[model samples]
Target chain A: MKQIFLCKDRLIFPWVRPIWVFLPLFILIMLPTWASEILSVSGFGTLGYQADNRSDVATIRDLSQRPKDGYATGPTWRLDSRLGVQIESRPDPRVDLVVQGLAYDHYKANLNNTITLAYAALRPTVNWNIRLGRLGYDAFLMADYRNVGYAYPWVRPPTEFYGWIPIFSVDGADAAYHFSGSDGIWSLKAQGGKSQVWMPINGGIGGGYHFKTDNLATLSASWQSASWRVKGAYSRFTSASDIPLLAPLQAGLAQVASANLPATSAQAADLLQHVSLEGARISYTTLGATYDDNTWLIQAEMGHTTATADIVPQGNMGYASLGRHFGAWMPFFTFSTYRPKSALNDTAYDLGATLNQGLRDPSVYMANSTRIDQHTLSVGVRWDFTPRAAFKVQLDTMRSHAPGCGLRSISPTLRTQDIHLNQLTATVDFIF
Target chain B: MRPLLTLLCCLGVCSVAMVQPTQAEVDVIVSPENPLRTVTASEVSDLYLGRTRSITEGGVSVAIRPYDMVDGLVRDAFFMNLNGMQINQVNAYWARLRFSGEVLQPSHLPDAQAMLDTVSHDHNAMGYVDATLVNDCVKILLRLGGGAHVPPSP
Candidate 1:
């Protein structure tokens, strides 16, 4: 890429950087009241650290964000540390405007992804709500509100369940209807949108990139009884942007096909077609249930995602946790697992074997990045030390049953045989 | 350093006081003009936890508002007897719902006097206060701990 300099360009709109334009606006979140009725501000944050016994691979809260390269050794604060501030304006009983800006470990350099929720909604009635803007992506049970550390019992949501979802927010609208059912209260929500998210990658593989999804539609329903809540949701989406790292490989395949080789040419073309994002589709179906009786809390969810991407395998992931409260303390245990149903196709592997070293390297990285075949056992305790804060510590021991990697970022130097890891984490979560 | 120690000591004492049971039981109350003369502890739980914002009155649905007295022994005892939930747990539950853009939280009043005043003025408002503070302006909905409270004459 090259650029030509001009005198007019230097003098016009000099402050075009994204950070400066939004810095002052974000500072206003510190003031909690603008005459109290029309405006209110609230926020949550966590001061956390993770101590790792095995550094063969790095740990990430989720694929959406990753820490710096060397932060995974011994102890690191970048994994679970985050701050989110939300400002809400309610001018009338039927209208509201909410904007939440979250600061976390981001893979992008710009401010576009920081604002998680910016929506203006119409509450025509107490039981109905419609909103159009950037809404939180409620892909799973706790995915939308996971940033609020004071809300949940564990130090964090189970990694195997929430790790694959990078969708922080979606650009679109949703309408929800709430009503009293014979058994309990029920709410149904339908949403549609287009979304784009920046994803992190190992520098050894490729630079961080952003991908877009179109025709994104989701339908979810939940019912709450006295102490039980059960919810189910299904969503479908199509990839609107190709993986940037795939461009080089696609180019290589095209070059080889153009040479008119008989067997390799057809394989190259077929593999090329399967790897495209033009019409690639993905769908997810998830179910979750929880029971909380003001003393014992139980939560579990299961989700299965099927996608057309050749590099990514379809799989099921779920976790269940049970905790009992004794005065101010809650001790819990969780078991989570992810199992892939299919592996790389024989044709793609054959092609990779015959291809040159340059093309083969990135293909391996792409395949590895999407792999998941692991289970984890975690034991944690949360102590509500104050009215608005809690202290929690967790120990996670994970083992992979196959060569495929778990949902965390892996160093290129990691060996497949070294598939066991034990990590310890502690955090103090607060809300204001 | 002395001041810091004193502050820590004060916080510890306040936390201990928050858990200790109070001798005076709180009473749930509503406006005298409001249609709801009595409600169960579970119904009050649902109202305060933000499960339902309206109650059925005279075969017609009537909107109701629930108010909370600012954090204190009254608020603490009300929650402790309502469902045995601590103030922190209740706050956490509301935080989850509030930030999720689901249900609006109960308005907070400065003190029992203010809560009584607000509820008595608004036909749709419901609140709880000290039993000894009740009067004819507000009617007793449900006595929390089976204690008898006589309303003062107008």
Candidate 2:
């Protein structure tokens, strides 16, 4: 596998490089013929400045932490700034091709995280359609357009729920069926594909990590009416990661097995395997609803994730938001929380007390490091000063009981202490 | 003297009413060739919001292509009364769908005349216009505010 160094520092596998290169070239070559009738170009972007009064680290969802460019001590533009471009060509009434690219600082630079959506759609019938290629993950209500800041009311979706799955694009095919009834429009979607997931790891010996999923499946249904929408989705994927710190632990367990300490070795192996990040099957289920009657906006989403591999914690997360429109100005409030089921316990290891302590400490630390019990409350105001643009200012205050587990930018001293952060972000979002 | 005071008050009221501009009534219109002569407010809302892509009438499915009169009181009033959403909210919804490649926004025309031309030419196209601009080429599907009525076609 070829690796691409990005963010001017990190290493990543370039799995979608070929598609990225070929798709744009194909569109450019065909642009002349389609320019007059079928080609349509559209875009949305956000320019933001954020300042946090707690830790110096700023986390963008779960992508990466901006340590070098801190949002905590001072304002940073790279934290929330992003741009996306989309090109759609519909040569026939039943067929269309869409390609979109996004540029943001997600531990990468120079458009490394581009190509968010690239798919060819076929409307076989009036009520059914199929899409093939790289499509947006539909695991949640806003999963498809989560990166488009202008689409959603919040400056950003609640990080606790939206941050769990970092992979947003799946390379595969999906089928959708639509039905219209007296109530509203209902749609059912099922997608199956694989994805390359890049998750930023903090408070670990290894500074960074990358994950890959071979089998990914998602099913979702939604009903939208004039004033209300309800949606439900479920997704499952098997993930594996490459982290350097776990190599020595694996070696130590193998050595114990060779020394004829079967009982001790078996216990150690179980502990180590449970905490490893390889070959883990993870599943996510979510239900959400939104009500927007032009004057009032109400949204709520709740999700639960279960992992077969113990390295990933089983947890539940949710958020509820309310907003009211006052002419061109809208004021909103949101409350979000994430809680893990149980802490890691390694009392079953039967090795000698000293050896057991040595092995158990690392495993317990690894498990505890992933635990997150946090709550965040946010208040914001959005001003639609123009038809195509909006200016927003938001204030967020978060408290994490699990410290480093829930909050990024965990300092050495604050790793064990409760973490509290207050952040202010102001942004201008526009579509063209 | 009482009659003179009453006459002065009437004159003052008439002048004030004359100075205030009345809001124009917006009318939703479709092509004359369309099979469905009239549309309910809910159906119009569904079509414009990308909720229902097609309308089945007389066992035939006619795909809908909704057009908008760009940036005006008529467009604002149409969306506000149809879905209770402002133009910004509607634009945001379309932006999400457009970027996700799910659906496209309605085609935007410069003014009511342009919308009239589009809806009049395409049988599947529907748009809104001021009632005064409604002509013989287009048929009124629904009336939004205070608007003149289209003469019954023979």
lDDT per residue as tens, model 2, A346-403: 5656577776666676766666666677889999998776667777899999888753
Task: Give candidate 1 misplaced runs (Cα > 4 Å).
Answer: A1-33, A70-72, A203-205, A254-266, A277-279, A347-365, B1-24, B146-154
Q: What's the residue-level lDDT of B152 in candidate 2? A: 37
Docking class of 1: acceptable
lDDT of each: 0.74, 0.74
Interface RMSD of 2: 9.4
- In model 2 chain A, where is the ten-residue run with the lowest total lDDT? A1-10
In angstroms, the error of model 1 at B7 is 11
Error of 2 at A228 (Å): 0.9
- Number of the top DockQ candidate: 1
Candidate 2 wrong stretches, greater than 4 Å: A1-33, A56-59, A69-73, A110-112, A203-206, A254-260, A348-350, B1-22, B147-154
lDDT of 1 by residue, A216-295 (tens): 89999988866888889998888767767678787887787677887767766656655565457888889999998878
RMSD of 1: 5.9
